[model samples]
Target: MCIAVFLWQAHPLYPLFLLRNRDEYPSRPTEPVAWWDNGEILGGRDGLAGGTWLACSRSGKIAFVTNVAEVGKVPEPKSRGDLPVRFLESKKNPTEFAEEVVMEAHQYNGFNLILVDLSSKSMIYVTNRPKDEKALVSEVPPGIHVLSTASLDTPWPKAVRLRTNFEKFLEKHGSGELPAEEMADKLMTDATKADKTMLPGIYSVEFEHSLSSIFVEANTDQGRYGTRSISAVSVKTSGEVAFYEKYLEEESWIEHTASYVMEQTGTG
Candidate 1:
């Protein structure tokens, strides 16, 4: 599971400021944030699926995904991680790409995919969860929003916590350059668990409580499972983008940063 809080077109200095926590088993092989061999995309890579949970293109496209917290999962469903990679690789805008996903949405387990194009100031949220209803595709408004294991901005305990803290930080920083590393340390590393009454009922109370924190850590029979990486992406109005990640590697935490300027589309 993953959770991300992003401010889209809400800040004057930054068109998009996003922070994400990728939660998974500690043993999973992962590559930290870096430019791909193609010299375009920038983000971490999932070693098992060769896909990414959050990534952006040099062309100013950004995408990230999170799993839905449902119990009755489809057996051997298509890999949801591929959603972000495909969107980044495609020429389609947010709406077009999301529409395509809706067609085969059922083939994958429940997911919440967010597609963003900084050049066009477009952000789309797509989800194929709550299987009883149609897959949802909607444009995300300009504001601070959290995408958790549930739908976007569903007010899960952690989501609300992140949003509230993030708002205070933004207000304090006051439109200047945000401290990406400091923000990650203060906001993404929080281990406060939600009260039992606030835990989502999709999973067992204990299991859901374990994941209630913004930074999740739990001991499971399979091994240690928790947030493996924290990523912060800040894109300035001048086209400069900074991507930073603090990730666990070989039982130690390492940090990396990649900086680039978005290619001007000249349309926006």
Candidate 2:
């Protein structure tokens, strides 16, 4: 399972956002995100890689994609990450954003993608894994959205315990003043401490408690800010293996986190 959250923040500002908890297991060769050899991220793979679960650019655009591998579905290529990234670079609104992918899905394999653009103050979700192209704009009364799976929000009996309080946390809250480390810790522990429903797959060697939590502010100087992360993996503990999180440098990760912040804060 792969998941990510974006948070917003203040800065030189192209609508900044922080990306926390972007963890995933890729196909062995890994899906590529751009044109290689040319130094462009156009969706290629390095042996079934994952972890590009969420990303943002200085342009105030955030995007993430997850593979829904099924037997009957078309064979996924080793270079599907490009689809999400491409969507990020394109589109101006949630509606246009969602429609483009549905219309052009033949260019890649099947997957679910969420795109957030602060420039237009909009968000959209698209998936081609089903028989039809499914897309939706972010809206109220939708509750916590769970993608790729049958249900949204915690589906397990144990996780169901914390739903009520967590929903309140997401609703009543605005930008946080908590320190980065503290917030991250809270995001990771808050779910478990209150109950088991903070996140769907919060416990596993593949999933660790390392990522503390992810927080983002939706309204800012440019209406975007974000921080913290809830990413954990056993491979990083082994020392021999290297696990890479998205947006390590440049203007990339900043936009990613700010996005989550925007989603949380909304355009208002």
Candidate 3:
């Protein structure tokens, strides 16, 4: 996922809410959101790597990851997509699992991972590419947060715009339910290139014009590149979860929805 915004413990009906845009080359093959027959996790699978950028288990554990943008960074042998998949499939506590990832983070390309245990009301944010070579992990405080390619809450134009829109949406709805479609619409809004100003380290004129918006469309050597999916999840305090996702399927844009009620024991 290139852009993501999440609200934790900020709603009365929904204890957790997530909206994210997965941007990539349009030609990449992918399987939309579904339960893997081999595992208990639910997510859209990356056709090339067989791992996922985001996923959630029936046990009420959620994970999402984004690549860290840095020019000329050497590619790692391990796939960063596995970070979220491994966490969701494991039995470790959020903190413990994050620590385990930190130890091996350098083996994979740079990435930011967010892990949430809904039943326990805990969230961990970890990243392997700090300004220094070391990793950083923290128990995220309850509120809204934005993550993109630069780093966690890096304040890039697109990230800031999306974060502000999210906060305003919550403020306007306050205690009322937000329609799933509207949430998806918010994620699809476009911010044209002229609206963005270059920030020295965070962003520059070299960024493709398509990247100025939450949704993207750019021409690259690999063909057309763009936002492939806009996915959102709503989790009630009682553990009822609703997932809404939109992506291109067979050359047409399609929306998919699924729901799972958490088991009382926090086990699928």
Candidate 4:
């Protein structure tokens, strides 16, 4: 599972500041954060699916997704990872794209997707889950929030921990440029697991507990699996954006940063 905490339209200098942890089997082939071959998108790619869990476009659009934690569900026909890619490549605004997604939400597995268009100052949260209910599409209110394997800010143990710590960090930094690397090391790397009773119970307590931490490291029959990378993205009001990632490759850890100024579309 993956987890992320974001401060949106709540900071003075940076309108959107986010930190994400990508957890998967270590053996899975993946490409670290970089500009895609098309040169318009930036983020890590799932080598097997050719899609990303999180990515941003040159035009100031950003999208990311997290899988819903559940059991006994058959796989869907489409890949959830494609959701983010489709949003980034679309000309439609966040609400429009989310509306489109709702039409085909049944084609994919359970997922929570966040779509953002800095130009429009719009951020929409879309989820196709609870199987019995219709897909949900709604605009995200401005504030600090968390998204994990459940609904947006569901108050899961890890989500609460991340939000609390992130609030403290913001208070201490006080409008200054955030230290992305330092924050990643101190906050994202936390391995604290929740108590058995605290688990969401969608899966077995043992399995869910294994993924309870902000950073996950679990060994199962599938082999070694856990958080393989941590990403920090900060978008400044000045149009500058910084994308940073610390990822694991061949048993070694590496880091990279990509910075660029967003294209100024007067509407933003």
Write down the lDDT that model 2 would get. Answer: 0.38
What would the per-residue lDDT of candidate 4 be over residues 152-182, giving only the tens digit for each residue?
Answer: 8889999999999998999999989889889
Per-candidate TM-scores read 0.96, 0.48, 0.92, 0.96
The C-alpha local distance difference test score for the whole of candidate 3 amounts to: 0.80
For residues 1-268, what per-residue lDDT tens digits would candidate 2 score against the true structure? 3333333322122222221343332113333233334332222233334335554544445566765433344455445566555665664555676776667665555566777655555556666654333333332122334332222232433223324333344445443322333333444233332223443453442222222122222223333222222431111111111112332122234211111122232322
Candidate 3 residue lDDT tens string, 3-38 = 888888767777788988899887787889999886
* Residue 205 in candidate 4, Cα distance off native in Å: 1.3
Task: For each candidate in the order shown, give its overall lDDT on alpha carbons.
Answer: 0.89, 0.38, 0.80, 0.90
What are the runs in model 3 whose C-alpha is more than 4 Å off? 131-135, 194-196, 199-204, 265-268
Q: For candidate 2, which ten residues in a row score worst on lDDT?
A: 233-242
